[model samples]
Target: MTDLAKTDRPRTPVLDRVTLPSDLKGLSDRELRQLADELRAETISAVSVTGGHLGAGLGVVELTVALHAVFETPRDKIIWDVGHQCYPHKILTGRRDRIRTLRMGGGLAGFTKRAESPYDPFGAGHSSTSISAALGFAVARDLGGDPGDAIAVIGDGAMSAGMAFEAMNNAGHLGKRLFVILNDNEMSIAPPTGALSTYLTRLYTGGPFQELKAAAKGAVSLLPSPMQEGARRAKEMLKGMAVGGTLFEELGFSYIGPVDGHDLDQLLPLLRTVRARADGPVLIHAVTKKGKGYAPAENADDRGHARGRFDVLTGQQAKAKSNAPSYTSVFARALIDEAGRDDRILGITAAMPDGTGLKQFAERFPRRTFDVGIAEQHAVTFAAGLAAGGMKPFCALYSTFLQRGYDQIVHDVAVQGLPVRFAIDRAGLVGQDGPTHAGAYDIAFLSNLPGFVVMAAADEAELVHMVATAAAHDAGPIAFRFPRGEGTGVEMPERGEILPIGRGRMIAEGHSVAILSFGTRLSEAMAARESLSARGISPTIADARFARPLDRDLILKLAAGHDALITLEEGAVGGFGSHVAQLLADEGVFDRGLAFRSMVLPDRFIDHDAPYAMYDDSALNAAHIEAKVLEVLKIGQLDRRA
Candidate 1:
């Protein structure tokens, strides 16, 4: 056992007893039950100190142990979809001591990361991608003449996604020995939705029919061949009445049980049976409860979807004391304020009401607010329909999620010039959720859309104005992106008024260089300005509001006047910074070779950590910005003591 897995404190034996999956080979069936109990206790204890995906980890304990025992992990590939439930998998795979540092800077990642451990076959943060990735591994193994099994453990909620269905259809047609375990916890962050949820509900309720058919078959076996044939025909008719038969069987997968996932006795035996079989594309449906063992998590309204540090016994969340209202809360209130005054105002989200701050709007104006169950494509078009019907619709989707609806933004909203307001949350490198959930591509994608009005909030005050600006503008599709967590604690304006379009306001004036920043990084630019001022270097700073319009006049004027232009934004390659470069090239602003750098998220995906630490690591912090400006002016690095 690794030293990290061992502690001086009296620890539970079930988890501590086993270091590798091979250790489970000696344990009897009875001992497996006891092991599951100890594992659950350990998981609860670990999450109490370091809050993360608690409910998911607890729910999958028995199944995880069973799979590890049955399959040779780090050899046989086991792909966990979304990776929120991989905490147990991580603990077992030699990262036990580092569990406390989950979601922190320079610590263990919160999700299944390929770079972090060899045990993680594929890295995932987004949902409904396991089956596709697992199938790829299965194909690779076959080509290499390897006989390892590829298993994809996907949740019932993730099954609702079109991508999951697409993978299933493709997997069925190809017909390989790939195994898909449908972990039916009966929930997504919220309750499951669409036709898939309905099918699962039918499967849950219609179990008695299977028993009746089995008993009828036993009774018919005593009869002669002619009678038996007729009875068999009747039995076939009976099975047609049950759900999950036609839908999955039609898709070409041999579907197995809606078995109890918590029962190690049932789970282990069923797994062994499936593993031994030489079938093509089999799905084992296992039902488990989210937050099964922990009392507090089990009782929470959302089933502890995402939680902060909490008292183990009391169930109260441990949060840092804050003087300012969260940005999400403020946005929610502002949306409500707008909705109250305008009868035509409507709201939409892609499976994140609570996260996107549309919960209140959903509660008060149920008809107007639509939660489109992780389908970003549908959400955009649905908002377009509302706009077409003379309603003012605000599509509140996270910036990263909007990437899914890029085609929709261009074809449905922008092409027709529908007046749809987009409240884009998590517009920057969001803390902890990491690159997969970061609002990195919205500015780039939305700006390129022909009739889109792309704006970024400088602070809480500017967010209010932008919200007003979006609401007031009926020209086309307008988006205002904001960062996650709290605002700058700035005093809000009495009334939100529209800012002039295609214009930027200067924060500070300087001659050496002008920093043209977008989105939440404006705060870092302010800090850089102060840093520059103290070092006898005065640099001008401007918050460019419209990324699509490019604030061309403002940027052109700044470029011509200043010695160098510095563009900073919290996004990936194709965002606001790229547009600035294109405009500069076209205008011949860089004819004499302007010393500039586009500060963006690196080419690789960042892991989960605090927002501040993530920014610093990605070189999006104030000190980095200050140093970059100094470097551009040939002033060398900023002296920290000076």
Candidate 2:
């Protein structure tokens, strides 16, 4: 049962008929307009229960309807960039039956997935990938793959990334019959930044409202019915203005639009014209408002970019309150506290100030903070430059997105040995957003980098100390990762302490087996120990705070004394555990009759689910740990075998 009762469901008469995009082909333009309205209402009702990206989907309802109505979809590829705005697309593509299951385990993905349906064409989660994927489809179609037109729907914020421009430049060179729809909603997850956004806004900025409205009326003379169409919306006539796509034109594409994306009159005719007449790469600039129909979403700061399950009538989210502060908030407070002690401490994020908790830092020290739009590569190198100039620059990014700048991290920061503080957030299997957004590889990648110091906080208290440690250390690159969501209700320090580099901390002492853990998995190790204790096996537990340096003495002591040893981390293979095994092998500890095992996230992409459920699937929880310990212990193994 959905959150909304069946009786409360909106009457979607036109939408009821739209079982698939093909069903939409017969609807009249007027009926299409009615369908767009009904689609918006249905989108709101579904997302109200499922709690996904409401605003973007709502904004594109008309566009979604118009595209399906005009194009032969499932054949003509429509690739949605970032894929958050694909909720409405999903509805039209025969997934409405599972629409309520958005972002849940074994349900509809929050972003587009290729495996989901034939209509998807290409999958995308991160921003700025649509054009490149669309171009590939276009080339493939010409080279005897699946036949169809290729269209890429990208947002203004995604356009800020260098890859988008690279794709555009390539598409221009290919000179293929492709469509790039620039959905200028004036928002990404964060408010869009950079000059391109400013340039896009200027397209419709200076026109007088009345004159633009009148110009819209004038265009109806060209239409079949002037009087009826002119009265419908003068906003559509605004497309008649000389809105030049100079930037897109320079890149080898013909440009059309500045059209109101919500107006089917504008969208239908414009898309119809381009589809029929375009010969080379064509870019259509559709001006849309994020959260177009819903008042609450329109008024919200993020324009309902993301939300929790909410009451449709009140927009009241059913969010469970947590007593503990979020790791993000703790990191923010710690960074703020440390910055107060040092004038040179600076904060930076790649268009995720709010997500990374740098919004608070930006509030306290506006000049000292920098949000470099969606350009992660630029943000990384920019931070490196700032660090080289004697500033303590903390480049904060989600571990997944930070991969975009791995080259910059290697060449500019790591090679030069700059004192750049990397604050990698969401450093584990992030739930709901699924595999694309999982922060699983940062440990493996960063740990191996020469002179790079890697640390993971076992709890919120340790995060504070790591923040202070990063601030105080003016040597090479240093990073500390913490998981998403709240801390474990641990007591927080008023200020951070500078922890000694490459040191591990002992949490408990026992015999037979020693459980060495890194990151938030330390808590799970402790739980496993408790379970093991009841079976007459009290396993030793230690937190290996540093992954890079390995805490040589601490690790050697644990391995030499224990009959069995295990390493745990929230990352994948070749990460913390792999490093530990390499160490044990190097020291010939494996020959000392010490049994060793490493528990990690399995080498596969775990799908969207609750964090606990996903962790359970990875077998990194307490029960799995207990079983591993039991299997490793010789006496316990013998008892089980007998």
Best by TM-score: 2
Off by over 4 Å in 1: 1-10, 207-237, 240-244, 592-595
Q: How far does residue 217 in candidate 2 sit from its true spot (Å)?
A: 23
For model 1, state the Cα shift of residue 626 in Å. Answer: 2.0
C-alpha-based local distance difference test score of model 1: 0.81
**Residue-wise lDDT of candidate 2 within 63-103, one digit each (tens)?**
99999999999889899999989999999999999999999
Q: In candidate 2, which residue ranges exceed 4 Å CA deviation? A: 1-7, 208-243, 635-642
TM-score of each: 0.91, 0.94
Give per-model CA RMSD.
Answer: 4.6, 4.1
Q: Which residue pairs of candidate 2 clash? A: 216-237
What would the per-residue lDDT of candidate 1 be over residues 222-304, giving only the tens digit for each residue?
A: 43233345445546755656454456767877665567789887678667766775458888778899988777888886777
Clashing pairs in 1: none
